[model samples]
Target: MQAGAGQTPARRSRRRSPVPFLIAWIVIIMMGTAGAWLYSEHMKQQITAQIEAQTARQIAAMENNYEQRIKELDAGYSSQIAKLQSEVDSLNELLTFTKDNASNKTDNSNKLYTQLSQVQKQLDELKRKLDMLK
Candidate 1:
C-alpha cells in the first residue's frame, strides 16, 4: 500500500455498537410475547363462549323433555280420574234402583197381611154360630 500525498494513514472503519442491536432484539422479543398473549386470550374467550352456548342448548332440551313428561302425566291422571268418576256414578244409580224396588215390595206385603187377618176372623164367627144351633 502507498500513502497518499496529502492524507495520513487510512483510518479503520468504525464498528457498529452492540447496544442498538441489543435494544432491537429486546423490542422484537417484547412484541412477539405480546402478540402471543393476545392470541391466547382470544382463543380462551372463544372456547368459553362455545361452552356456554352448548350448556344453554342442553338446558333447553332438558326443560322441553320435562315439560313433555309433565303433560303426559297430567293426561294419564285425568283419564284415570274420569274412569273412577264414571264408576262411582254407575254404582250410585244401582243403589238408588235397588232401594226403590225394595220399598214397593214392602208395601205390597203389608196389604196382603191385612187381608189374611180379616178372612180368619170371619171364619171363626161362623163356626161359633153353628155350634150354638147344634
Candidate 2:
C-alpha cells in the first residue's frame, strides 16, 4: 500500500514476547500448587484429630474395665476376710473347751488314786488267809 502524502508509513504492531506469558503461567501454577498443599495439610490435620478422638475413647473404655475388675476383686477380698474371721473365732472356742476339760481331769485324778490304794490293801489280806488254809 502507498503511504498518504502527509501520513507516515504504518508501523507494524509489536508482537508480545513469550517471557511475560511464561511468567503469568508460572504464577498460576505456583498458586495452584500452594492451594493443593494447603488442602492436603488441612486433610492431614483432620485425620490426626479423628485418630486422637478414637484413641481417647479406647483409653476410657479400658479404664472403665479396669475399675470394674478392681471393684470385683475388692468385694471378693472382703468376703474372704469375713469368712476367715469366723473360722478364727470357731478355733478359739475349740481351744477354750480343751483348756476347761484339762482342768476337770486334774480334779478327778485324786479320787482315782484313793480308790487304787484301798484295793491294794484288801488284796494283801486275802493272800494271808489263803496261805493259812493251805
Q: Pick the TM-score winner.
A: 2
Q: Candidate 2 on 1-134: residue-level lDDT in tens?
A: 78776666776457989999999999999999999999999999999999999999999999999878767765665565555555545555654565567766754444444444454444444444434433
Report residue 100 deviation for candidate 2 (angstroms): 3.4
Prediction 1 global C-alpha lDDT: 0.68
Q: Please give the lDDT score at residue 32 for candidate 1.
A: 100
Q: Alpha-carbon error at 54 in model 2, in Å?
A: 0.9
**Model 1 C-alpha lDDT per residue in residues 1-134, reported as the tens digit of each score:** 77677656777557999999999999999999999999999999999999999999999999999878767766665565555555545555554565567766755545544544454454455445434433
* Segments in model 1 whose C-alpha atoms lie over 4 Å from true places: 1-16, 95-134
Pairs with backbone N, CA or C atoms under 3 Å apart (clashes), candidate 1 = none
Supply candidate 2's per-residue lDDT for 108.
47
